[model samples]
Target: MSEGAKLTVQELDKRFGDGDDAVQALAGTDFSIAENEFVTLVGTSGCGKSTLLSIVAGLEEPTDGSVLVEGHEVEGPGRDRGVVFQAYTLFPWLTARQNVEFALRDEGLTKSDVRQRADQHLRMVGLERFASARPNELSGGMRQRVAIARALSYRPLILLMDEPFGALDALTRQLMQELLTGIWEQHRLTVLFVTHDVEEAIYISDRVLVMTNRPGRIKAEVPVDLSRPRSPEMLSDATFLEPKAQVLEAIREESLEALE
Candidate 1:
């Protein structure tokens, strides 16, 4: 693990099945995210990107190795880490505000405190007006906002997201990306995001980790050198294009090999 890393994965490995029919999904995967740094993982399909994220989220256990947050090994899901998935995992019966409050149920806060925190986070995500709306009543983007607010309600040290905007249309997805970056800027929490969108990874990440196919491992780490307070216009600028091309080339190589 690197010094002062907020989260660290050391020699991680994961496999499923047994004997001759076994399948290996990851091998010797290692990386670290610094405090308040934004890191994204990109890889070809079925390269175990989600698997790695799951391991860090403590939703799934690794076959070997460990994940440490602030030098403490992660044994299972805890309040220290917040998770947002591609699917909006909000409870159907509850309104948006209630959904966020549900995450704080075990936080041992007063009812008024919980309600205030839920409203505050919903406002943070630009959904204060929709607080009373149920999941079925909200748009795809709105639902995701509620999900993000819920994940953030408890103030986790690390935010783990897996393609949280993947279900939206292109326009909605772009808007969601911008929204996420804005929230990240304001909150300044360590973020480990997994996505298949090369441009999205470049636009939002301080460092992008590219992984190999099948039994995945970090194949390359591409650092985004674009100036912060990133604007949409910068996406087409030379500085952004340079790193974008590098990340794309790395993924293309692994993608091509996966099709072999």
Candidate 2:
């Protein structure tokens, strides 16, 4: 692990079942994300991309090795890391503000403080005016923004996202990409996002880590090297195209292997 790395996964491994029925999801996967760095993981389906993120989030245990955040071993899901799933998992019964406030309730803040922080984060995601809207009332993109705001409400050291915009239409997905990148830049939040979209990975990441199929392990690491706060036009630039091709090629091989 690098010095001062925000999150470190050293010699990580995970396996399920045993004997002939055994399945290995991760094999010695390792990487590190620095403070406030935005890194993404791209791979073919079933490459254990989600499994790795879940381990880091402390949602699941690693069969071996360790995941550390801020130089300490992560024991379980603590307040130090926030997670946003592809599903906009807001409580339908709770309004947007209430959902965000729920995340802050464990912060030991006064009720007023929780409400205040929730509103602040909602504004950060451009949803302050819709604070009262229920999840059903909001669009898919808006609900995802709520999820982001809720994840951020408690000021976690890092954010873990699993294809948060995968469910949106093309135009909505594009808009959310811009919205998420701008918010990440503004907040300087360290992010480890998992996606299958190669262009999306290149557009919003400082580095893109690709994994091997099944028994997943890090296979390729492509640094974006693109300037921060990227725009839609960057998609057409040669700089963007090269790294995108590199990532696509990496996954293409793994995808074929998976098919075989």
CA-lDDT, candidates in order: 0.94, 0.93
Which runs in model 2 stand beyond 4 Å of their true positions? Answer: none
Candidate 2 yields a Cα-based lDDT of 0.93
Lowest-sum lDDT 10-residue window in model 1:
251-260
**Error of model 1, residue 11, in angstroms:** 0.2
lDDT of 2 by residue, 38-66 (tens): 99998988899999999999999999999
> Quick one: best lDDT, which candidate?
1
Q: After best superposition, candidate 2 residue 235: deviation in angstroms?
A: 0.5
For model 1, how does the per-residue alpha-carbon lDDT over 1-260 read when each residue is reduced to its tens digit? 79999999999999998999988999999999999999999999999999999999899999999999999999999899999999999999999999999999999999999999999999999999999999999999999999999999999999999999999999999889889999888879799999999999999999999999979999999999988777799989998999899999998998788778
The residue pairs that clash in candidate 2, if any, are none
